[model samples]
Target: MLHKLELIDIKTHKITKIEFKKGLNVLHGDNGTGKSSVLEMIGFVLFDFLPENQADYVRETHSDKPEYGKVRVWITDIKGEPYIIERTVGKPGVIVKDALTKSRIPEIRGVNQLKAWIGRNILPMHEIELGKLFDSSIGIPQGTFINPFLRREGDRKAYFDPIMQLGVYEKVFKNLNELNKKFEPDVQGVSETIHEIIGEIKIKEELLQEQESLNAEIISLAKKLTKSESKSKGLKEKYKEIKKIKEQIDEAQKKLDELNIKSEKENENLIDMDSQLRDANTAKQICDETKEAYNKHIKLSSNLEILEQEFEKLNAYKEDLRINNENYIKESTHLKQLEEVLKKAETNKKKLPKLERIYQEHSELVNKIKEIEATIVEINAKEEQQVKLEEKASNISKNIKSLKETLVELPELVKKYNIMKDIELRIKEHEIDVANLTNQLEFFKNNQEKINQHKCPFVDQTCKNLGEGTFNEDIFNNKIKTKEISLQDIEKQIEKEKEEIHEKEIFREKMDILEKDKTTIENYKAQYRDYQDEIKALKEEVRIKPQVIKDKKE
Candidate 1:
């Protein structure tokens, strides 16, 4: 029970102190006269209860000046000892003490601490328990009493679950139901797995039967494989002999190709030497012809020197004339340029007055245009400002339209949010269901034999009537091995074909090279013969040169 409540400068109301008796105490006052406020303060000091309009209780209202205040309550313990608990508004600490003994109780530094201390040491019950008791009994707000009854069953359960301590029991019941739900899938999965295992067992038995037949077939195939291996051995021996012969042929061919190449080069060198010999004979004939021309040139040399002196004097006179002509042309061009300049100056002088008049007019027009442009600029500035203002107005209108649209859709959006929350909750529930079912399924899959033996409570029937599938395991393995052998054989054949093709291509390339070398050698031999014939002709022609030139040459 609250013994007393003291408010100092709290909301600045007129009533500052209130005393309560041992029995029921009632606070009756007009509205806005601190009747409800006093009750709220009592609840706050005792249990840290805050009102919806808590700012009103803390705000200064009486004067313009700001002030700090406190809400202090005297609470009586179960032994009837009075304790003062005070909480300063807008402050960080709480003070609790023995009122009669005037000894300070241990201070609590926070609202939670103070509430905890009061609930433990001063109050007859825990704070939450007392609050529930008070709310259900004497402290019922208007309309709250009937609200629970009006709510849905789930909502009502939520409200009362904590008060009745039924949450744990409900959670346990839900978990059990979930476990049971999980067991159902487990039972079904176990049935299926048991059937599968039975089928596998039957298949293994069938495979054992098939293995006997496959063994006979394997013996036949092994005999055939031995014959093929023996044949392959004979082929390998023959192939090795063929390979040795081919290698010998390649070596002989290589030596023949080298000899052909050397012969072609020698032929080329012979042709080149023969060509050089022809060139030398031609040079000798040329030298003989040049000797005759040299004699003529010596006879005319003195006359040519005198003519060259005269030609030099004439060339000097011609160069002087060319210089005079260039000077004359330059002067004439300068005179023409001066005349054109003078003519242009005269024309400009004649147009000066008119130009000055035009300049004055242009200046006046420019000044007028500047004034007009300034006016236009001012107008454009105003227009730009108007455009900006219009844009702002348009933006404001758009904002208003958007706000109206939002207002129109707010209820629907809120409904969607609530629906989404409900869906999320349902999804979570379903996920848990899925997890339980999956776990049960996995358990069943792992423990199929147990389920088939009726060891699981959820499984009522065994998988005795289920059909077991059969598989020929040994036959399947033998087929796989056969396919692998076939694949290897095919790969070996492909590699052999590739090697043969490569050898054939090399042989063809070598034949082509040998043919080209032969053609080159033939061409070089023919060229050598032609050069030798030309050298003989040249030598004969030189030997038949005029006796006079020949004596000079000797």
Candidate 2:
């Protein structure tokens, strides 16, 4: 029974695996989706079959040529004995492996051998009978897949027997006999992988959020630019306002600069505004000379002038300090008050040294406090830097995780690339052999009679395969057959190599991307280390905070 199908680099399929269940297995898709191709792969893996050129089985790719296309199928006989059937294009042999142990069975090394062995072991038929039986039935006519099953008995068997060998193998073989292979892909350390995957998802979400925020900022900035342009005139006016000075102050300053009080000529300009503003003596002289009203007509000038003369006489008693002192002093009270004042002065003098000491201590305390405050400010600044470093490290951790995953894949790709290179070398060797043999074969046919017996028809200076048998008519025919087969195999290998190499090249291109990120990961690591160093320093500062406060209190 057909159990599972695996295809690699086969026509339109790159890498795909399909598991068959208890019921119907449907290949449903549009045209050129490789629906029929899947059926072909299953049949090929089972019977070691190729309906067309083997080169066509390998996938077409854009990067470099591939060396092989592969197909694998798991099946079992009526006894529930499990086996794996494996086939590869660009390589020889049909490998039938034990499904349990994955070791090759010694028999069935070739296509005919595989069919013969399958007939003998699993069914009661010869290779030719098996071929005849399957040839008409296994093609899987498109659109009529289920129609044959809808028909009765013999008609249904024609379409279905080739797939499962159900006619003689009974229900167990029809059910694919407990090989029951299911494709369940899992990673080692799956829990850790899940955590990492979750972390990556979170990081990606954060980045998306940040991108949205930046887009918002861009929109906001554009709006601000428009608003700023509209208010340009107001801003310009405010900027101009900065340079303005009060004209009144400026005028007064200018007047002060021109003021020259040393000469009467300068005074003439000063009196030009207020002529009635006279010198005091000059006004007094005028008042004494004419006993008239001060500003306008008034007749009491004589009495007021006598009173002003008496007020002026008080300045004559300025030298009578003895009498002033005697009037100020009381004999009993003066000496006692002076003694009390002296004692208080002595007391204040005695307290001055203590006050100075207290002042000094306070100054030192204030300075120590200021120093602690400065240390605190510095610690805060570094702590902010530490926070920024952590955020940056977080971003790099995400990057490093991604790069490491890629790195894990690089070694496998490189291994494949090396294998492809070896295949290319092999292809070249085969091509050279084919070219030389082709030249010899062409020469031998053209100049057959000119060469003597056993002198070598193609060689004797023309063909250089020295120890090889002479090119007689029989040998010639055999060579032709050998050449045709060799050419076919070489052609298939070359075409398949081209496709496989392209795929390997695609994987190699990722090595370039990986190398680029390799440097980036290194830089990130260096930066992360620096962040750790700075954070550690900040932590040390934080640790000192309590001690600093304790010292400050003391």
Give candidate 1 regions above 4 Å deviation: 12-15, 124-138, 167-554
| C-alpha lDDT of all candidate models, in order | 0.64, 0.70
> Any idea what lDDT model 1 has?
0.64
TM-score of each: 0.29, 0.35
Model 1 agreement with the true structure over 433-486: per-residue lDDT tens digits: 433343344333434544435343234444443323232223334544554555
Residue-level error in angstroms, candidate 2, position 141: 65
Model 2: CA > 4 A from native: 1-344, 448-485, 515-523
lDDT of 2 by residue, 1-554 (tens): 66788888988888988889877766788889898788777656555455777887788889876888888888876678888888887677578888999888764557755664575556644313443344456764657656756874433444454445544467666566344432123334666789999999999999999999999999999999999987997888877675454566687787766664445666786786465556666787988877545544453666788888987777656647667767667755788898999999999999999999999999999999999888877877877877888888888888889888878877786678667655654554565455445545554444443343334453345453323644443555566567667767877777877776667557658867887888988998998788788778778777787787777788
lDDT, residue 403, model 1: 45
Model 1 TM-score? 0.29
Point to the candidate with the largest lDDT.
Answer: 2
